[model samples]
Target: MQDLAFRFLVQLEPENASNFVSLSNLHASSGRWDSVAELRTRMKKKGIRKMPGCSWINVNDEVHSFYVADKSHKCTDIIYTVLDSLLLMMKGEIDVPGLGCMK
Candidate 1:
């Protein structure tokens, strides 16, 4: 599924930095840090500066914004830790129905 999405992205915008950024994000989410770093390098080579990373949350009819490198919240580390934990858990025995597979 992710491969298909990545293919589509590259097809739509072969050299777009935004597409590379999205790809890097996907790779990071999948614990593929090497790929992420590679994509980042590609972006740099293409003279593409990354768009500022921002996140938003709605609370009490107000929208709160956060940016990358903001120390107010440790969002990056927290998410990385969560993904690491999930990877560790996935390394152990896991039951899958119908496919007769275990991980």
Candidate 2:
């Protein structure tokens, strides 16, 4: 199912802009930083500038907007910490025995 979805995503038009951006984000989430960089470069070459980074939070029926450069949100540190934890877990799982057993 995931494979089909991924293929469908990849088949999206190169001009969609968001498609490439989504692919880059997926790669980054899977620890493929180099692929993300390459995709970003491709997007730039195709004259598709990335949209400015922004986030929104809903609080008491109010939507608060936060930009990457905004000092009010520490998004960078939060993302780094999450990624660090994932990396540690991945390393530990890889070190486990019998998981990769080849009979």
Each candidate's TM vs. the true structure?
0.46, 0.43
Q: What would the TM-score be for candidate 2 when compared with the true structure? A: 0.43
Q: How well is each residue in 10-93 modelled by candidate 1, as lDDT tens digits? A: 678877777787788889999999998987787777777866789898879978677886656546678667767767666654
**Residue-wise C-alpha lDDT for candidate 2, range 1-103, written one tens digit per residue:** 5434644765766666767777777888889899889888887888887567887879899887877666565466785677677786577743435645531
Best by TM-score: 1
| lDDT minimum window of 10 residues, candidate 2 | 94-103
Once superposed on the true structure, which residue ranges of model 2 sit more than 4 Å away at CA?
Answer: 1-7, 53-103
Q: Each candidate's lDDT (Cα)?
A: 0.75, 0.71
User: Could you tell me how far off, in angstroms, the CA of residue 69 lies in candidate 2 after the best superposition?
Assistant: 2.4
